[model samples]
Target: MKPLVVIPARGGSKGVPRKNIKELGGKPLIYYTIEAAREVFDDDVICVSTDDKEIKEVVEQTGLEVPFLRPEKFATDTAGTRGVLLHALKFYKEEMDYKADTIILLQPTSPFRTAQHINEALEKYHFGLDRVVSVKETDANPYFVLFEENEEGFLKKSKEGSFKRRQDCPKVWELNGAIYIINVNSLKNEEVSEFRRVKKYVMDEVSSIDIDSELDWKIACSIYYNIIISRNIDSK
Candidate 1:
């Protein structure tokens, strides 16, 4: 099935400041995602949806298409991810008359994904699966170790507290938001319907980094550097 790559980048970045365009390892952070997509898909099929002119320029420099800019309203901090994704999907269909069986939603903050990881996720997305996302084994399983705050301000366990041993609890998956390949039908039908069947392409913690803040950025860099060092072994 044909695929379309969508990179959603907005201008206002509060955490890291101009994060999407910021250089990571000498290349703009978004460049990694664009490059990986290029390695796996044609340039015409890849699209970067952004609101900032600077971000658009960075995307074009990578030789990717910025088919449409997300509306300022939708690009605001208040706009939810679901709304942003729905708007992007609608834009390509309505404005560009583009259609793809698979809509690949890749977050720029996740730069560690390799072309191999992308292909692995795609391999899981056969006709049987409705959606596929990059994920990693969670160190702390939410089913066992998570907590919830009650209205009385007491910290209560998210699940039953009776499970005395962490190992006894079932393992649960946490989405790493790196790469997601969702069926276009389910995407337009309900904006990533929670009820839709989903699959995962599990990656190691090193490559599964989700850079949400300064700390996350640091951790991701460490992981990236480590991976590079390992690859350089015996090359000398």
Candidate 2:
């Protein structure tokens, strides 16, 4: 089945301001995702769904085409990903006279997610599944220290478990906000939030870094620098 990689990058970023095009590790943050997608899929199938003309120009500078600028309504902070995905699908069908069997969402926030991760995830993906999402071992497990206030306002364990030690508790996974491979038919029929037959593609801590705030941006810069330094040392 043919796969299309959709990158949702709007101009109005409240967190870091123009975050999608913001420079990270000497390149626009969105450039990393675009480069990664290009490594796995042809440029024609990789769509950057954005409402900002500047972002569109930046993406095009990478030699990957932006089919069309997304509508203003879908670009809002209040907009949902479901609507974005559907709109891209509709565009491909109506305008390009092309259809994709699978839609892979590679968020620009997860800059560390690379082409290797995408290729590995696709290798594991098989037909008939609802979706495949990348994840990392969560630091907060519901069975452990995580808690929620009850109706009476007393704190209680988020999930019930009798394990005496945190280590003994079952390992839990959290979506790393990296990659999402969704079947087109399933996406069309149901919202991604409602998918049941989902599988997890595990990644390490560094690769799981998702930039959402200023602190996250700083942390990513540190990590990126360390990685580059490490690579340079290894080469020599």
Candidate 3:
């Protein structure tokens, strides 16, 4: 299926300021997502939607053109991801006259996600559905470990289950903020937040690392360094 890959990297990052352009694993963080997209699809089909001029310039240095700077309204901290995606789809359709059956949203935060993960998710994607979002098995098991305060201020299990051990409970998944494959027609008709029919693309914990805070960034760095060290040792 023909797909348009959109990598949204707006400026005004509060956590780890300028994170999109910040060096991670020896390169700009966004470069990882852009390169991964290029590995799977033609460069022309991959678009970097950024509101900051610096981000656009940095992305251009990677040899992939930034189709357009996202509008200021969509770059705000309160702006929803769905709006940014819709604007991108509109730009491609009206300006470039390029029509794609599906859109693959790859957030720059997920640097560990690679072309292989995207290709596997694409193989599982089918039209007429809302979306296929990447996820990882949640480390927090609500059934046995997590608790919520009741109206009476008493703690209660978040999810009631009879399992004696957390491992015995049914597995739960959470969005990894890595990849989202959406049906173009479905996206145009309804916002992604409103979609009820969604599928999950499960990824391992390390691959699902999404850097949103300084702690997360540090963890990513440690993981990256370990991988590099392992590869280098094997090469010798």
Which model scores highest in lDDT?
A: 2
Better of 1 and 2 by lDDT: 2
C-alpha displacement of 67 in model 3, angstroms?
1.3
Q: Compose the digit string of candidate 3's lDDT tens values, residues 22-42.
A: 999789999989988989999
* TM-score head-to-head 2 vs 3, winner: 2
Which residues of candidate 1, in runs, are more than 4 Å off? 150-154, 161-163, 232-236
1-236: candidate 1 lDDT, tens digit per residue: 97878888888888888989888878899998888888999887787878899999878876566877788888888987666767776776787787677888888888988788898888889756678888887767666778889999998778675677888777767788888988877766675656368887888877777777899888867766777557757467
Q: Each model's TM-score, in the order given?
A: 0.89, 0.97, 0.95
Q: Which ten-residue region of model 1 has the weakest summed lDDT?
A: 187-196
Q: Each candidate: what lDDT?
A: 0.80, 0.92, 0.91
- Clashing residue pairs in candidate 3 are none
Candidates arranged by TM-score, highest first: 2, 3, 1
Clash tally for model 1:
0
Predicted candidate 3: what Cα RMSD to the true structure? 1.5
